[model samples]
Target: MGLSYEELMDKQQWLADELTKSIKAEFNKQNIVIANGIGRNRDGALDFSLSISDLDNPDQSPDVELIDFAKAKMKELVPDSDANVVGVPTPKQF
Candidate 1:
């Protein structure tokens, strides 16, 4: 049976938290934010996207190795999710 929308969202949230913790453990100084979403891809398969951003240092370049590591770890956590990681600027706070 397919997971309900809420269950998928919960899983996404859990994955995000796990990724955040894992990354932070290695890169303690960086302000890392891991945002994730679960949705269907073009082929209608379950897919996910993880956005890893440094909120405090947007100008500084992100570490490619770190992103790759995060992607790998995310994939290990959810084998079914075709997870993609991208760097995005932090939204301006009001």
Candidate 2:
């Protein structure tokens, strides 16, 4: 049988908590800023972005390795979750 509403909610909360902890640990280990955001345009299109940077030195932004690390952690926490990144270009030199 499929999960009940309550079961689904509990799973979601658990996933959130797990993801939060994983993210925090990564941030502390790498001393990076994980910038995340979500929004919808007037045309009803959804948009989101996730990026990382060295908190100790804003000029030292994160690279693909860091982004991939975060994405992997997120996927580990929520096996079925999907994340997409659009046109926002990654800094060429981080």
Candidate 3:
């Protein structure tokens, strides 16, 4: 019993929503703003950015938690797909 295309899409959307919630929660708890942008580059590679306002303060930094959340969500959404978390630079050190 394989999942239908629509079912797969729905599952993907659910996973995305779950990830977004986790991201928002972390940002709120850390009193930081996260700017998220998703798109495909000229080379056809999917690019997503998660920008945090502060980076130096451990309590306000979201990098490690974001990476962990992404990794867990990726595994849940696509068990066989290869997904890796890429860290991005923040605007300033807290």
Candidate 4:
């Protein structure tokens, strides 16, 4: 059975918090930020999207290694959770 709405929401928050912690630990020196959101996919499944960016250089995208690390951590953190996790590149903000 799939997770209920409340469970999904909790999972979303948990995933976001964990990802944020992992990134901070791995890139302590850089002023990095993580933007995360929860939404439903076409199939009605809960999906989580995480964006990583650096404030020092907003134009530059996060390194591929960092993205990979987040992806891996997401899998390890919730291997069988009912939420789909996506790592998106942070866009430059004005």
Candidate with maximal TM-score: 1
lDDT of 3 at 6: 52
Every model: Cα RMSD to truth: 3.0, 7.7, 7.0, 3.1
Q: Roughly what TM-score does model 4 have, to 2 decimal places?
A: 0.68
Model 1 vs. true fold: TM: 0.74
Whole-model lDDT, candidate 1? Answer: 0.74
Off by over 4 Å in 2: 1-30, 39-48, 85-94
Candidate 1 wrongly placed segments (more than 4 Å): 1-7, 40-44, 92-94
Give per-candidate clash totals: 0, 0, 0, 0
Error of 2 at 16 (Å): 8.5
Candidate 4, residues 1-94: lDDT per residue as tens digits?
4455676667776777788788889867356676766666446776565677766666677777877888788778876443444434457566
Residue 33 lDDT in model 1?
Answer: 86
Report the backbone clash tally of model 1: 0
Please report how far candidate 3 places residue 15 from its true position, in Å: 5.1
- Which model is ahead, 2 or 4, in terms of lDDT? 4
In model 1, what is the error at residue 55, expressed in angstroms? 2.1
Question: Which model, 1 or 4, shows the larger lDDT?
Answer: 1
Q: Which stretches of model 3 miss by more than 4 angstroms? A: 1-17, 26-61, 90-94
- The 10-residue segment with the lowest total lDDT in model 2: 81-90
lDDT per residue, candidate 2, 11-80, as tens digits?
Answer: 6545444544665686564444344554332343443334455555545545565566666776665444
